[model samples]
Every structure is written in C-alpha cells, then in structure tokens.
Target: MKAVWLAVGLLVASAASAQDYAESDGAMLRFLDKLTSVTGDVTLSRGQAAQFGRLVVRLDSCRYPVGNPASDASAHLTILDDATQTDLFNGWMLASSPALSALDHPRYDVWVLSCILPEAATEAVEGE
Candidate 1:
C-alpha cells in the first residue's frame, strides 16, 4: 500500500511540474487529531513553522496557477514529530489531491487547503 501511494505521488508530482505557477506568500492548512476528533486550521507563511501537540509543521513554499486561486494549490512542507525528532512528511502536497501524498501518522492528519497568494499576484492579474 505504501509503495502504491509513493508511485501515485510521484506521478502527481511530475504532472504538477509541467504547469506554470506563481509563488504564494503562504498556505492555509488543516489538521485533524484522529484520536480526539479535534480539527483546526492554520495559516502559515512560507518559511514559517508551527507546532501542534508534538508535531512541528513547516511551510517551505506555496504555489498556485498564476492568478487562479480556484485552481490547484501545491505546497512543499516538512513535518516533524517533536517527540522523536524524526520527519513524518517532507514533500509537496496537493490541495486537490491530498491522498496522493499524505502524512502517515497514526494519530494525526495534515493537509493543505489553499494558498494565500501575495498582493502582487492580485495586482498582476488585474494588470492583465
């Protein structure tokens, strides 16, 4: 099952690479505490990191189709388990296809929801 998911993730990553995207200022992500059924969202700027419970989540980069928020959102993330100081996930995760590359934690679920595009992106769209 893990291998299959890895294969799917690679395919999705390759497909996404073919598109033109604009860098976003940050990303909006969500997490679920599987054991407690608690859910929450976090807004993280690129290069920012946040901690939830024993997990430390970092936003590396965020991007979307230029001027198209309704389109796909992709974010590069690095998540670590503070309890063990080991990485849980370190890759790009797609908002439209979260299952393609997901965190394999036993008690937590994290995924990208959308990107917080920069003001420059809005202006660029308006200029066009």
Candidate 2:
C-alpha cells in the first residue's frame, strides 16, 4: 500500500509539472503575439517603445523545460531599419518578483517593447 501510494504521488506530481509548463508556454506565446503586433510599426519612441521591441525578440527565442516554471524566464528585443544599420531600441524582461513554480500552470506575467531607428529598419530583421 505504501509503495502504491508513493507511485501515485509521483505520477500526480509529474502530471502537474507537465500541465504547468504547457500553460506557461501558451501564455508566453500569446504575449509574444501581442508584442510583435505592437512593434510592427516604427512610430515607437526611445523609452517604452524600444523596450517592447526587445521583449518580442527575446520571447521568440525562449525555450523552457517540459515541466518547468517560467520563473527564470527573461526576454530581450531589438529593431533595425533595413535601409540604415541603426539600432532603434532594446529592452529586457526579468522576473523580479517571486513567481509561482509550475505545480499546475504558469503564474508569472511579463511584458516588453523595443524599437529600431529608420536607418536600421531597412535591414532584414530576425529575432530569437
């Protein structure tokens, strides 16, 4: 009976971890989509606008464990105008607050933005 119960507990824990990872990934993806849309334009300014661009790039390159929380997840974004080799903006996201570990799903929320200069905007941009 003891062994059976132990096995059951482990199984449950494993399942919970998997669920958390999936939820976190989904949330992050959604957030990325939004960020991309916002950065698609070059009207952003130097402060917050630049930060959002960095966030989109960072999130796009993110990779998480199958059953891990995004507590340590961070992102950065950068934009460039193809015509000019100028970097418009850059930003980063770090989990400053205590984020929930995935027991069932991700619980942390992150946002970021960044923008590129008109000169760099002409370059073929790639973010990861």
Candidate 3:
C-alpha cells in the first residue's frame, strides 16, 4: 500500500509539471473536409471566427511548449454548422493527438497547428 501511494503521488506531481504554453494573440489551424476530400489551413486571432464550408470555427486561444514550436499544440475552439444552426464542437483539440479530443462532424475535421505569439512575447523570447 505504501509503495502504491508513493507511485501515485509521483505520477500526479509529474503530470502537474508537464509542458503547457499559452499564446495571447492568435492560432493557426488545419481543417480537413472529408466529404469533399479537401484540406486547408486558417489563421484566427483570439476570439475571432472563420468560416469553412457550412461550418463556422472560432478560436479562443492556442498554446505550445515554452520553446519548442513543433512540440504538441492545443487550441480551444467552438465550431457551429450554419445549415443546421447547431454547435458541432466546443473544446480543446491537440495537434499531437488530434483524435484524442476531436470534432465529431461527418463533413469536417479540425486540429491545431500552432499558436501565433504576440509581438511582445516573441520579442521577449528572442531577446533572451
């Protein structure tokens, strides 16, 4: 019992210290339309919305690792289908693991690419 409790505690501590970065400006996302077999990328500033086919996607924010841009990225999104007037997805999508938390739309699939860093954040990091 004592050994099991120690292992659990270590796992929790490591998970808490895992890499997570938040961007303030905008996010870039790649979306695939499975029905049409077409794919494209879109950039959206925080709180801004863009339309892809009949689906409207809004980005709340995006995040990547502190220094590794190619590392795992995640974006908070809200997607709505105008034709049906229903929200299809409203949650975070991970770039490294798109299928983990994904939009369940038959026609469209959306995933994060990277978080666009604000000028201030960029400058600060580059200055170091």
Candidate 4:
C-alpha cells in the first residue's frame, strides 16, 4: 500500500510539472508573436542541439504618433531543455526622450522573459 501511494504521488507531481511547463511555453510564443508584428528583420539562430539557439527581433524601427512617446525595443529569446527553468524568452524595450533623434536614443527600457510550455517546445523557436 505504501509503495502504491508513493508511485501515485510521483505521477501526480510529474503531470503538474508538465502542465506548468506547457503554460510557460505558451506565454513565450505569444510574446514572440507580438514582437514579430511590431519589429522587422526577425533573425533566428539554432545551436547544434535541438534545444539551443536564440531568437532576436529588431524593434528599432517601431514608430508611434508624433505627440505620443516613441521607443526602440529588442527581444532575446532563449530556450533550454530543462523543465524548471521557465523556458526563458526575454524582451527589452527602450523609449527615448524628446529630441531630434529621440528614436535613436531610449529613455526607458523594459525586459520580459516567459517560460517554455509543452506547446511551444515542439515548435521551431529559431529560424523560419
């Protein structure tokens, strides 16, 4: 009876972990979608292994209303094979002050990283 209980506990823990992973990955994919839409010249790098590489999106060209604030953004997405690492996908956005070339400089910068979930794990994160 004790052995059975232990096995059941392990199974439950495994399932929970998997679900968490999936949710995290999903979030990253969503972020990527948003970044791609806003930025041009999306570049992807793949490592030797299936789990390596970085997804870089250039957000310098993003434009906003003249009166409104303008900013430059960049996203660095990294994926690992581990389940506990949150499958990090990070983004950095910078806003410049009011200047002739404000777009060239950034006043504020933001960074975000999301975990990797099951759905995103199967998809090709880097390259086309």
What would the TM-scores of all predictions be? 0.78, 0.23, 0.76, 0.22
Q: Predictions ranked by lDDT, top down?
A: 1, 3, 2, 4
Error of 1 at 57 (Å): 0.3
Regions of candidate 4 where Cα sits further than 4 Å from its true position: 23-128
Local distance difference test scores for all models: 0.89, 0.33, 0.83, 0.29
- The number of residue pairs in model 4 that clash at the backbone is 9
Of candidates 3 and 1, the better by TM-score: 1
> Tens-digit lDDT track for model 4 on 38-58?
422222222111221233222
Q: Count clashing residue pairs per candidate.
A: 0, 29, 0, 9
lDDT of 3 by residue, 9-114 (tens): 9999888656456564788898899988899999899999988898899998787676655566788999999899798999998888889999997788888887
Top-scoring candidate (TM-score):
1
Question: Which of the two, 1 or 2, has more lDDT?
Answer: 1
lDDT of 4 at 123: 47
Please state the error at residue 122 of candidate 2 in Å. Answer: 38
Q: Top lDDT: which candidate number?
A: 1
Model 1 compared with the native: what TM-score? 0.78
